[model samples]
Target: MSYKVIVNATLAKFSASHFLKEPFQCSRLHGHNYYISVEVEASLDENYIVVDFIELKEKIKIIAQSLDHRVLIPELSSDLAISETSESIEVVTNTNKRYVFPKIDVILLPLPATTSELLAKFVHDKIKEIYPNKRITIKLEETKNTIAVYKSN
Candidate 1:
């Protein structure tokens, strides 16, 4: 039988968030260098190889670059009725502070929470968008040990 191997890649989710919901309001308005890893299970065509590491690395880079250095706000989600303008993007937050992405390269992901679980699903969906038919597994980690994994069939 033939076997295949998968790989992992990660990027920092640079954004500020208030950790707790009420009272303490912990999060500290900080950012996380979110790490994202992807695994692709592919049996080599007839050559007994999984896939090209170079090609995979490039693809992963493209996705991470989109989110490398921008202020991530849940208000920037896809589900929100939001719009971007030349001057700035308007976001209504409980803190009532002005948070904006300084550059156009910054990407705002549509997720309910900045937690690991949401991040995993977010990356999985993003990869699926790039490669529609490939069965892939995704792992999103906030730090070295903390992580969330995802798979698509």
Candidate 2:
């Protein structure tokens, strides 16, 4: 039989800034208090356990802390022209909108965009690395009513 465990969004959250490529309002830089919830499914171990709650929460905490209070930049976006200096990173969209941010305040993700769907996959992959044999699901909430989900089988 298989068992499942979850780390709810309420207990695992982070604040970060990001922008999307389309959807006019989202194209402008903004920040959100993002929440991430994780669900892991796997057969119980010999000890009749799926996973330790504390351990899973700690791992999620680490990933959240890394993204907290940072500007997420998509390094793989063809729609963006990015440049960096010792102190700052500059970005310009294909539409010619420009932005400059401090290097220390940014996180360059290897993604085409920082949309919630991609971010959910990003988080799913991170957790998958830690639990290679288990099924993982990540629910990423960008706002109160908007959420994106990613699953790894």
Candidate 3:
């Protein structure tokens, strides 16, 4: 049988901004206090545990820290063109909207969108990179009522 270890510590908090390309209010840049939860599925090891909760939490915390307090930009968005300089990053959208952010304040991700769903997948992938033999489920809460989940099995 397999067991799951869950971690949802308050330390998994990040403040980041993103904008959707859809023609809506969300298209404008906005920030969120995102919360992340991770579930690890594994068979009991010789230690009689699915996985070490402390190790999992620390790994996830590292991922959160990389994105905390920054603007998330989707590097693969065809509708957006990104140019980087030593001091800043320039983003020009297909609609001709332009935004400039300091290089120190941005996190350019290899994703197509910056929505919660995609963020969950990104977290899942990052975890898998560290624990390729384990199954992982990631839940990313964008707001008090909105959450997106991604699973790897």
Candidate 4:
């Protein structure tokens, strides 16, 4: 039998997007209370039927600590209109206006836009870095009613 674990991490963020050929990748600037759920396939330890929630929380925390609250900039983000400085992030829109974000904050660079599907995959990758040879699944929820999952091969 396999055991599963779920961990909660407090998260906040900001971003923008617009579809192809449009201009921006997202509709407009937006943020969400992002939650990450990681599922590991392993037998329970000698004392329990699954890994301890605290241990799992620590594992998940390593990744979450870097992204808890800040701007999420997709490397695929359009326009190449971003500047990183010691104080703030300067985001210049396609139209030439700029938005600044405080530094010493979280800024995640995802390969894809901050959609649930892609975010799950991104989280899966981070988890893999911790367990190089083990299989795992990552689930991300933008809202309680919605979620996306990525299962490793």
Candidate 5:
């Protein structure tokens, strides 16, 4: 039999901005203070633990810090064009909406959309990179009432 361990720490928090193209109201730029929760599934080790909680928390913290206080752009979005300079990053949407942000304040992710569900998957993939053999679930809470979950087996 296998066991699972969950790590839900306040440290796993990030404040970031994104926009959704389909929903007109959501297409406007907005930000959220996102909370992340991670669950790891594995058999108990000799220490009688699925994994080291401290180590897992640290790994998630690293991922969260990278996204904190930044604007998340979908690098793979067909309707968006992104360009960068030493001082700033420029984004132009298919509708001719343009935004310029400081280079230090933007994170271009290789995703089609920066929705909560995709964000959960992104975090899950990042964790999987560090724990390739582990089955994992990642939950991203965009707000008090909205959350998205991604699971890998």
Candidate 6:
């Protein structure tokens, strides 16, 4: 039989800013208090548990902390031109809109857009690194009514 372990502690959350390339309203930069929940499914190990709850929570916390209070940049976007200098990063959109942020306040991700679905996948991959071979699911709540879920096959 398969067992599942889920971690959705209060600390597994972050506040960050990001923009999408579609839907005019979302194109404008905005911030959100993002909540993350992770679930790992696996057969029981020697300990008769799928995973340790404390360790899972800690891993999720660390992932959230890395994104806390930062501007997330999708470095792989074709519609965005991103340039980095000694102390700052500049982003120019295909529409000629530009944004400048301090280098220290940015986290460049290998993604095409900073959408909730993609972010959920990103978190799933990070946690998968720590618990390889297990089926993992990640849920990212961008707002009270909007949430995205990603699952590994």
Each model's lDDT comes to 0.59, 0.93, 0.91, 0.64, 0.91, 0.93
What is the number of backbone collisions in each predicted candidate, taken in the order shown?
Answer: 5, 0, 0, 5, 0, 0
**Candidate 2 runs further than 4 Å off:** none
TM per candidate: 0.70, 0.96, 0.96, 0.70, 0.95, 0.97
Candidate 5 C-alpha lDDT tens digits along 1-153 = 879999884669999998888547888999999999999998888899888889999999999999999999999999898999999999998878899999898999999999999999999999999878789999999997899999995
Which ten-residue region of model 2 has the weakest summed lDDT? 19-28
Worst 10 residues of 6 by lDDT: 2-11
> Global lDDT for candidate 4?
0.64
Error of 2 at 25 (Å): 1.9
Residue by residue across 38-144, what tens digits does model 2's lDDT show? 99999998878888888999999999999999999999999999999999999999889899999999999999999999999999999999999999999999998
lDDT tens digits, residues 1-153, model 1?
434445654332333332322234443455667766777665566555665667766767776666666655554443334357785655544454444444363355666545567667777887778656566787776666877888886
Per residue, candidate 4 scores C-alpha lDDT tens digits across 90-113 of 766556656676765537475545
> Native-vs-model 2 lDDT?
0.93
Candidate 5 has which clashing residue pairs, if any? none
Give residue 120's error in model 4 in angstroms.
1.4
Kindly list the per-residue Cα lDDT of model 6 for residues 1-153, writing each as its tens digit.
Answer: 888888873559999999999556989999999999898999999989899888888889899999999999999999999999999999999889999999999999999999999999999999999999899999899997899999999
Q: Which sections of candidate 5 miss by over 4 Å?
A: none
lDDT of 3 by residue, 1-153 (tens): 789888984759898999989697899999999999998998989999988878888899999999999999999999899999999999999889999999999999999889899999999999999889889999999987899999995
- Judging by lDDT against the true structure, name the best candidate: 2
